[model samples]
Target: MTSSDPGALHAQTLSEAPCGRRLFIHALNAASGEGQEWVARLRELGFIEGEPVQVLRRGQPGGEPLAVRVGVSTFALRRAEAACIQVMPADAS
Candidate 1:
């Protein structure tokens, strides 16, 4: 995968993000991180380390908006924005 490609970096879903995996903020397109608002929101939503995330959907064809579940809330984030966040498969088994 290219250095700027988030989706290309990994191909696993949230349900597969087990419990002790390490995931990187690959992208977050329209989610917005300006002024750290998005970052704060994400943390509040439980998008922190050791948290499990599942990829509900890949958004549209371009992968702009993706449906992901962090902790108990599901959010639709833009590709560019998703690229900023990082994550790893929680399940190592």
Candidate 2:
């Protein structure tokens, strides 16, 4: 990743974030082949760049679904969906 890349510089997929820690949206990656619709839907749900988010909890066992909070809303997302979202430490900026 380059310096100009928003997903670079201490960035990591949201699914990998630790529960209860504050994080900020860095960028969205469509490389997973989830299509533009998936990206658009995530954005529509307030998963925009610079938005603060938190991984509230992860499902037991395989950790398929993750409970996340963005802005004023919270939603459960599959690990694949959460993988599409890049995030950084809330103190990075």
Candidate 3:
């Protein structure tokens, strides 16, 4: 049997990362009650980690607005807001 290559593992980890891809909530960071509410809304929209999400569309060439889809719902999010979210690749394998 072939053992997993450490380099391959690391590459996978980086490539499957959600850093550049719009992803589901996965988990929420510390925040105020209002912040939690907003996070909850995102969750309700299927912004949970491991959920299928795609960058359905992007806003202006270099704008913050981006169209993302969680399940069947599509929402627009700012780059800063998107950064708060962490996600795993939908096609990790």
The numbered model that scores best in lDDT is 2
Where in model 1 is the C-alpha error above 4 Å? 1-35
Tens digits of lDDT, candidate 3, 1-93: 123633223222111333346433344432445556666766767677467666665566775476777678778876655544545444432
Better of 1 and 3 by TM-score: 3
Count of backbone clashes for each model? 29, 0, 2
The TM-score between candidate 1 and the true structure equals 0.55
Global CA lDDT computed for model 1: 0.53
The candidates, ranked best first by lDDT, are 2, 1, 3
Task: State residue 68's C-alpha deviation in candidate 3, in Å.
Answer: 0.3
Worst 10-residue lDDT window, candidate 2: 29-38
Q: For each candidate, C-alpha RMSD in Å?
A: 7.4, 1.7, 7.5
Instruction: Assess candidate 2 and give its lDDT.
Output: 0.89
Higher-TM-score candidate of 1 and 2: 2
Q: Write the per-residue lDDT of candidate 2 for residues 1-93, one digit (tens) a residue.
A: 578865496899998999999999988877456546778899999999999999999998888699999998999999889988989998886
